[model samples]
Target: MIVSITGATGFIGRRLVQKLAEGDHEVRVLTRSKENAKLLFPVEKFPKITIAGEFEWKDCIQGSTAVVNLAGMPISTRWSSEVKKEIKDSRTRVTSKVVDLINGTSYDTRPSVLISATAIGYYGTSETKVFDERSPSGNDYLSEVCRVWEAKALGVDKDVRLALIRIGVVLGKEGGALAKMIPFFMMFAGGPLGSGNQWFSWIHLDDLVNLILEALKNPSYKGVINGTAPNPVKLTEMCEKLGEVTGRPSWLPVPDFALKAMLGEGATIVLDGQKVLPLKAQELGFSFKYPYVRDALKAIISL
Candidate 1:
């Protein structure tokens, strides 16, 4: 099978690309920087990987089994007017181009499916609400971004199956929420980010990749699927688990005001969170290797 991926240099995209290469499928990494993609996936190790730039992106997607769209600006920093515009445009604009490419393809050359990335932030942050794929989109900046992002993906041809993965916080060894939090724990200054009561809906990176693979292969994997572990936990609980695994104390607490001051509006991502669950994945008979927060933490720390 041929798979074309955008955002191939990102945290999730890099792992997804590696997994696809391991499966021995032809992988085309569509990036603005073919040079960077080549750096990440050298011919020496990833012999089956092809690097594609904007000029070749259309050709790479033609007749491809799947086009996995994961490109976007990272939402893990402070927000200014310019930065907010960047975050929104980075997703919606890219998605528009992908849709145009897919829709413009000849009937026989169109991709079979389009697996696009969204975020659990679509549900917005609420200390009390538990979100599933069926929930309505929230009325925040991130939620609006997600809504527009998915709408753009929905423009794909009627024959092409579309799976919008509304991802949660991904826990991994190299980079992600875990990477940011681990250092604090190692220094015995780690604890919950804000109130310690916000939900930390998360998935192990491997589980997330597996879910994407399932979506790629299974016809049943259409529409919105929450890419989160079955079990969600409060930030405080997640901190406790991290403390246990790393043999560090969960004592220091980051004040909510501090997070807000630092991240500006972006602080809502961590200071307030939604309890998102992978209900669609469950209905589709998907299983997670690390369902619990502690187990997920153990697996990550062991790595």
Candidate 2:
């Protein structure tokens, strides 16, 4: 199978590309810089590198069995009005381009599946709610972005199967929310972001990539699937687990106002969270390698 990926240099996307390449699939990546692409997967290690520019999807997507769209602006920083526009455009615009390419391609040559990225933030910052793929979207900055992003993916022609992975916080050794918090934990300054009650739905990086591969290979894996662990843990529990794994203290606290002041509206990315569960994936016979927070943290920290 030929797999074409956007945002191929990103944390998860690059790893997905490497995995697909190792699976003996033809992997093509859409990147802005050939130099950066080489840096991501050295030519010596990954001998076959098919590089395409941001607008060159039409050229690169030919003969692809799947096209995975993971391009977007990071929502981890302060969200000024300008930055918000960038956050919205970075997702919607790129998705629009991908849709256009799929629509324009000839029937026999177009990719069969579109596995686009969404976030668990679609459920919003609900401390009390248990969200699944069937839940209605929440009214928040990130939720709105996710709604539009999924809508664009759904607009594709009926011939293409669309799988919108509503992703949660991914726990991994390389990079992600865990990478940002590891230093603080190592220094014994790590704790829950705000009120420790809020739920932190997360998935192991390997599980997330495997979910995408499942969507790519299985025709029945269509529509929205929550990309989160089955057992969601409270923020405090997550912190405590991290501390246990690293032999550090998880007693410190970060005030909500301080996070708000530092990150503006973007603070909600950490300050608030959703209790998301992967019901669809489970019903479709998917199993997670790290279903518990303690096990997930231990694996990541040891790496």
Q: Quote the lDDT for 254 in model 2.
A: 74
Candidate lDDT values, in order: 0.92, 0.89
Q: What TM value does model 2 have? A: 0.97
- Model 2 misplacement above 4 A: none
lDDT by residue for model 2 (36-125), tens: 987887878777668877667688887788899998888888999999999999999888888888888999999999999999988888
C-alpha TM-scores of all predictions: 0.98, 0.97
Give candidate 1 regions above 4 Å deviation: none
Candidate 1 per-residue lDDT over residues 222-297, each given as its tens digit: 9999999999999999999899999999978978898889899888889888899898999999989999989989
How far is each candidate from the true structure, as Cα RMSD in Å?
Answer: 0.9, 1.1
